[model samples]
Target: MSNSVPMTVEGHRRLQEELKTLIRVERPKVVQDIAEARSHGDLSENAEYDAAKERQGFVEGRIQELNDKIARAQVIDPATIKSDKIVFGATVTVFDVDTEKEATYQIVGEDEADIKHGKISITSPVGKALIGHQVDEEVRIVVPSGVRVYEITRISYT
Candidate 1:
């Protein structure tokens, strides 16, 4: 579909696992909970019934969301990619021009973006600036603090 979303292979697999768990475990448990709540007599004043219905709604909504995401996911494997220039799923080591420090980051899809883990979204300021650039290329990115420069020292797909 035109609305497809890029997702790393690992991220796609994790999503699939969550979906499976929801369907196999969460769904059945919610159903059982609702059934037990209904047996408590008088659904009008039963807090357990209300709570179970709310949980059911949440589970159903989450299931639909996960299904949609999985269906539209464009799984990309980083290990299979090869390029001289920066591209999605590329793990790049860089040197900060202003701070004289070094850091490494992986250009990844939005769903897999985790700055704490060194995985950045392709649409992020630094990621956008680094794309299509090769080693030793200086990339300038404007963030909330200020403009920061980075020199691409290395690029690896694995």
Candidate 2:
């Protein structure tokens, strides 16, 4: 990409680990699978060969994609930052205005987004609404499901 991809140190580390696995473990195993399939001799009728070739293509494509992401990554460590306003890497606790409950979400990069784990991408509707907001601030965000209202309660590095 022409622009750097913003991410947390943890997200960067995860991508690097995936890349390393694809290169060291997956690449060699796929290569061996291709060779073994090739030994079957009949190219057109070789289903194993076709499957192995497809797998190789997938692995190679993922490796290249991961390499590009890693090269363009702008890693930010949350633990190293201290900010009152919600920003990237900030773990925020929000009180739902309608649900009468509170939920915590970490503002993270796209690759680190996992709603199930309470990590929301900075570009997400809720995350966009939360940025630059401080504790006790009310935020209104329009999502695909509907509009959401949240009150910022806490902000933590971790």
Candidate 3:
């Protein structure tokens, strides 16, 4: 059985837009390129044909991948979830125990994970450790470097 994919409304919309672009623009362009390449003299000696075929394969694979992800997506609205505890789509403020630095992260799905943007995947080590915890709770997470402790300072949704 496939695990449920939890994603915010914005994330779902982004995926839909990507799929639309691939189908409407990329697919047709790749097909035309392949057809044009095929019209050239010898397929064995044609670099254009090989390149076009490779590009077609890549585009088709991405299209299928996007379709599968969209099909399995379980859209969840952040506003609807109660503010009792930290959960998926929650913006959490944490204080690093070692450095005493403050950082905030919004728990998100794998597809939407962008550390620079502070959108962390719920499946990540830090996110997994923060799940179900409440504000003021101290949590320990194991990173590639080592285990680090973080104290949850605040939680918000937006």
Best by TM-score: 2
C-alpha lDDT of residue 144 in model 1: 83
Q: Quote the positional error of residue 91 for candidate 1 in Å.
A: 0.6
The models' CA-based lDDT, in order, is: 0.92, 0.94, 0.92
The list of candidate 1 runs beyond 4 A from truth reads: none
lDDT of 2 by residue, 53-130 (tens): 999999999999989999999899999989999999999999999999999999999999999999999999998999
In TM-score terms, candidate 3 sits at 0.96
RMSD of each: 1.8, 0.8, 1.0
Best lDDT among the predictions, by candidate number: 2
Candidate 3, superposed: residue stretches over 4 Å from native:
none
User: For model 1, what is the error of residue 154's alpha carbon versus the real structure, in angstroms, after optimal superposition?
Assistant: 1.0
lDDT of candidate 1 over 1-158, digit per residue (tens): 34988888988988899889999999999999999999999999999999999999999999998899888988889899889999888999999999999999999888789999999999999889999999999988899899999999999998
Which pairs clash (backbone N, Cα, C closer than 3 Å) in model 1?
none
Candidates sorted on TM-score, descending: 2, 3, 1
